[model samples]
Target: MAAVSPREERKARLAEAVWRIIAERGITAVSVRTVAAEAGMAVGSLRNLFSTQTGLLEFSAELMVERAAARVTAITPSTDAVAYALAAICELMPLTPETRREFEINIALIAETPAHPGLARIRDHAHTQLLDLFTRIAAMLRGETAAPSPASRTNGRRLLALADGLGLHLLHQRASDDIGWAVDIVRDELHRIKSAAIGD
Candidate 1:
């Protein structure tokens, strides 16, 4: 892998600071000054990286989406489509510490969307990407090598809803300590979809 440039590293550090603040203190606590303090950087340095708090928030949110997407893309396709689908979908859940932090940041950004209308675009874009991922998974579950059909898209939306619900429940219930339950739920759902497809 190529080395990360100093400027890129600094920006990543600042973005991490933003995520930490959002995860720990909520979105309300995120600001140029606070993020600078969290990152142990000067106010001017943080400003040089991000001119405004919205810019900081947007970058952090974008980075979060990018990281999640990268992880999903890295999964090797499996003959067991159900297992492959579960692996990709589970990356979106807060099952691990890293993913839990990302989930918290995601929730915080969504909650602030009303006040920060700019964030709505990022959220919507991420939603579209996720929907597309689910559609592909739906096609895979049906053993279809062709493009996703309208029915596949519909099923994808349902799968997305299920995933969102599961993530929220896990976050609300603090179920990270026992993530097997969520994993089983997803695995069962995938099997059900596969069975339904085979039946049809």
Candidate 2:
């Protein structure tokens, strides 16, 4: 991999500081001063990078999406459609510490969207990407090579809803809790969708 530039490294550090503040103190605690302090940078220096708090928060949200997208994109393509679909879906859930942090940051950013309208665009973009992935998964499960049929599209929406609901629930669960049940729920849903597609 290529080396990270100085500016990119600084931005990444600042975004991580934003994520830590959101996870520990809440989004309301995220200000230029607090983030600068957390990142161990002077206030004036932070200003040089991020002129406003909104810009900082927007970059943080965009970084979160980029990180999640990278993980999903890294999944190895599998010959088993169900296995591939499950792996991709599970990557979105807060099953591990890294993913949990990502989800926390995601939820915080989403809640602040009403006040920071800029974040809504990032959120919408992420949602569209996820929905497209689900549509492709639906097509794969149905053993189709062509564009997704209307039924596959509907099933894709259903799968997305299920994943979203489960992810929210998992966020509230304790770290020690056995999340195997949640994975099973996703597996069951995938099987049901696959069966339905086969029937159609």
Candidate 3:
């Protein structure tokens, strides 16, 4: 393979530095100068790689989601429906140092979604996909034999909202160990729905 471009390597290093700073301090800590300092590069070179502040912020957001996706994909869940689901949900949280930084950067980006034009679309897309994921997890627990209803769709969104809310809370040191709690909540809702059907 061809050698990695110096520019590309520098961009990756700076992105990593931004991620680290965001985790240690906060997203507001991420700036051309700060990241350049962390990466031990001149701000000019960092700017050359990003071209603009928005570009770097946008890249960080994308990288956050990409890292989360990789974490989720590394798991191989059991065939047991609930077991499979809870296992998958475990992947979404910042369980490791690297993932923690990733989550931190994403949370910081969420705060700037309004002021940062680059992050608006990324935030929207991330939420949309997360809800879709919840919807799928709902269907899996319910089984395909039973068609998901309008109420089921609403429930799926609620579950995702809970997960996202808890994510932000944990990022801010407000909530602790939401991963299992979230999975339990979803499973409980599923059972509650089935029970309601049985009584009907």
Candidate 4:
């Protein structure tokens, strides 16, 4: 197979550097000059890839999504309900260093972009993705014969809300944040929703 082109390689390196900066300091460290310096290149070189500050920030957000998606997708082939549910839930939690960094960076971006429409766009997009993942887990937890009902879907949304809220709290260190806690919280809520949906 052919190797990646120099330009593509440079952009990839630059993006990775941006991740490192955000992960270590914060998004406040992400600028054309800083990112280029981190990438061991010139500011002009970095700008060749990202034309504007908005573009660079948006690409950083995209990297976060890519990382999150890959983590979530790892469990897609599993048929075990518990494992699948755990996998879905784990996607929201920052269990590893990489995930912790990504979530921290993304949250900082969310905070900084309040005045920009990109904030809502990226935040909503991430929420929608979480909802979809939770919906699938909700389905498995509901049982094979259960159908998707209004109450069930709402329950799915609620589960997503709980997970996101817990994840955010965990990230902020304002709550007792642990993987086990996140799992228990999700499972308990999933049970309530499933039982109510099927009238058990």
TM values, all candidates: 0.95, 0.96, 0.78, 0.83
- On a 0 to 100 scale, what is the lDDT of residue 162 in model 4? 82
Candidate 1 per-residue lDDT over residues 138-194, each given as its tens digit:
988987889997878888999999988888888877544788988999899888878
Top candidate (TM-score): 2
- The number of the candidate with the highest lDDT is 2
State the lDDT of candidate 2 residue by residue for 1-200, as single tens digits.
79999998999999999999999999999999999999999999899999999999999999888888888899999988899999999899888888888888898899999999999999999999999999999988987899999988998999999988988898888977999999999999888888987667
Q: What are the clashing pairs of model 3? A: none
Please identify which of the two predictions, 2 or 4, would achieve the higher lDDT against the true structure: 2
lDDT of each: 0.89, 0.91, 0.71, 0.74
- TM-score-better candidate, 1 vs 3: 1
Candidate 2 residue spans exceeding 4 A from truth: none
Q: Model 1: C-alpha RMSD to truth?
A: 1.3
Task: Point out where model 4 deviates above 4 Å.
Answer: 1-6, 144-147, 172-178, 197-200
lDDT of 3 by residue, 1-200 (tens): 48979776776787788788877888777788998899898988887788887898788787777667766677786677666665666567554455555666677778898889779998888878777777777666655446666655775787677666655655665334444554566567656644454443
What lDDT is obtained when candidate 2 is compared to the true structure? 0.91
Measured by TM-score, how close is model 3 to the native structure? 0.78
The alpha-carbon lDDT assigned to residue 116 of candidate 2 equals: 91
Mind giving the per-residue lDDT tens digits that candidate 4 earns over 88-195?
677657666666677777777788767667766877798787777677667667774456655557767888778768777777664334567767877778667657
By lDDT, rank the candidates, best first: 2, 1, 4, 3
Q: Candidate 1: global Cα-lDDT?
A: 0.89
